[model samples]
Target: MSQHSSVAGASRPVKEAGFFTKIKNVACLKSSSSSDKGKGGKGKSKSLSNKVSHGFHLVEGQSGHKMEDYHVAEYRKRKNHTLGLFAIFDGHLGDRVPTYLKDNLFNNILEEPNFWKDPEAAIRSAYSSTDKFILDNSMQLGPGGSTAVTAIVIDGKDLWVANIGDSRAVVCERGSANQITVDHEPHAERRRIEKQGGFVTTLPGDVPRVNGQLAVARAFGDQSLKAHLSSEPDVRHVPIDSTIDFVILASDGLWKVSC
Candidate 1:
């Protein structure tokens, strides 16, 4: 079945969450529920056991520029296992890259030959291949790019997370938050960019940027800055247990604003 979501020209809000000491609840795109799109581009779903669910809300940004963000939240059956897929693709310059990712990234990753035996290696391979495809077809996809954070839950038993740029995933376990992805900001990876013959610039009042153009040092597409950018993602694996509550996959406003 198709995903329950993908934001169009709108960087929608995720689940409505209010944090007061006693953590109430949060939402995710339901893994087993049918599409539940409502007014204003919203959708909700629940897992087969009804133990976990997801929801989304869309809202346009006030930056004047059309929103380029896109997302994925759905479930798929593969090899007798139920896989819950979630992701956030924060784009800049245009929406082409993120839109393409929302539609194709997971497919490519799942199609990797070694995905079942060596998930990490398969994920890396797919990430590299996907980025190559995007860069190779820059003319058709445009010169824009996107930062991404993706999570795959295997029957609520294992969780796999991977990311590039600054899109992030935060997991709540026993009511404590833990970040499992790393941000590839220009400032953090300066030496690497310089080694690629690109320089990072930090003006007095601005954040560090790759060659003074893109704010992130790694992402998909960005053919114009491909030489200085990396598309490799930092992937992690976490075994799920009773203590784990939920995971939030998104690029917070801090990352969103810079892009």
Candidate 2:
């Protein structure tokens, strides 16, 4: 996997207004205050279940550029033990890499022998293995690449996050947002890339990118840059407390538009 330019060329003009308008419409429709009074004055209410103590919600926004290749998944093994995993694979040139990651990464992690005992090690193994799997199967996948950021929430008490790209995970607690996963941007994550002899630059007609090709510094599928881009994820064991609220996991599209 090698990074390629996603910057729209001269043919694709940026549609700022249309992009934001669609986002606004989707946001409004999902809002609790939105009224559904067409067929009747009553709106469908979310069922409350006392047995269901914890739940998960996921929403994927469209890509402002080509297709939204990002993928997300949330699963629970048992009623009390919940596992929430979300990934943003910013694909460049094609969607094969992201789609491949979405289908295989979590399963690889869960299948690891050490997963039940040591989640951090399991995550590391899973990341490396998945990357290798992609490279081995690259002939079947075309010449595209992707950045990966994944988070796993276990039992609503522990969070293990891994990343190799600019996709972000933010924890909104006590009315404030705290970034959980570090954005693997060349500019911000310069130290790591520099240690590996990698650099960042902007092409003559392209957006700022890592190594003049990738916009992100770390990633799993960039086989060409494996010597520089990392696959080891930053793992943290966080205990969910009273002050914690819902977290937001989004791709570069949302972060680029918002930040």
Candidate 3:
């Protein structure tokens, strides 16, 4: 099994060469209130009611390149309190964008001055700002793009999830699953794309792609397609009370097969 690293408080960029290439890895984080089960999960108890214990798993796709999916788990100790974070990034073309996100997305989000007072707005601003950074620093990121789904847990009870592109976050309550983020596929968002003067096309044997390039309507990077694509994420708040169980965050590789 590959070992996951901690980027909790480091102020630096993640080296691309250190990107994970394993199919399964395990890491125990000293954080609070969040758990996730990806597709193909086994041995997980169904009755986790109100308790959060997380485990993540990933496998490379048949696509002829390094796995483009990346996940984040970190704990930060502040002067007054501690923060727990979890996230998933699914990249297309190259893993640089996802790698960058794994290292910095939440740090950017939490650094927002209004995060404690207005988390939703803070998340939105952070996402857009992060996307801009990716674009401005494209020389290091390359021409690829990525999707993101992130979760923030406060006091192990209040939960917030944010996403761009098709990667997803789902909550399980008493064995029933409920999606917490929206998938931004080109097909479902055709109208929005057309409104922006962009087109979605389904070429022979391929799903719809924005300008026939990206399958997702929203993403970070893809500098050439930025005007047609969006980086704004859909953010939602869910209270981890008695009725809720755990959450699932996965890339399209798992979601497409599971569904």
Q: Which scores higher on TM-score, 2 or 3?
A: 3
Q: What does the lDDT come to for candidate 1?
A: 0.72
Error of model 3, residue 105, in angstroms: 0.7
The alpha-carbon root-mean-square deviation between model 2 and the true structure, to one decimal in Å, is 9.9
Please give the lDDT score at residue 23 for candidate 3. Answer: 16
What's the distance in Å from true for residue 199, model 1?
0.5
The Cα local distance difference test for each model comes to: 0.72, 0.57, 0.69
Off by over 4 Å in 2: 1-65, 78-80, 189-197, 202-207
Candidate 2 residues 25-91, lDDT tens each?
A: 3322322311111111111111122111212222333434455344554444744465656555667
lDDT of candidate 3 over 159-249, digit per residue (tens): 8899998878877655466888999989998998999889999989878999988889999999999888999899999876766655667
**C-alpha TM-score for every candidate:** 0.84, 0.71, 0.79
* Model 3: lowest-lDDT 10 consecutive positions: 1-10
Candidate 2, after superposition: displacement of residue 92 in Å?
1.6
Overlapping backbone residue pairs in candidate 2 total 4
Per-residue lDDT over 210-232 for candidate 1, one digit per residue giving the tens place of the 0 to 100 score: 99998888999988899999998
What is the descending TM-score order? 1, 3, 2
Instruction: Tell me each candidate's RMSD, in Å, in order.
Output: 5.9, 9.9, 9.4
Report the C-alpha displacement of residue 235, candidate 1, in angstroms: 0.4
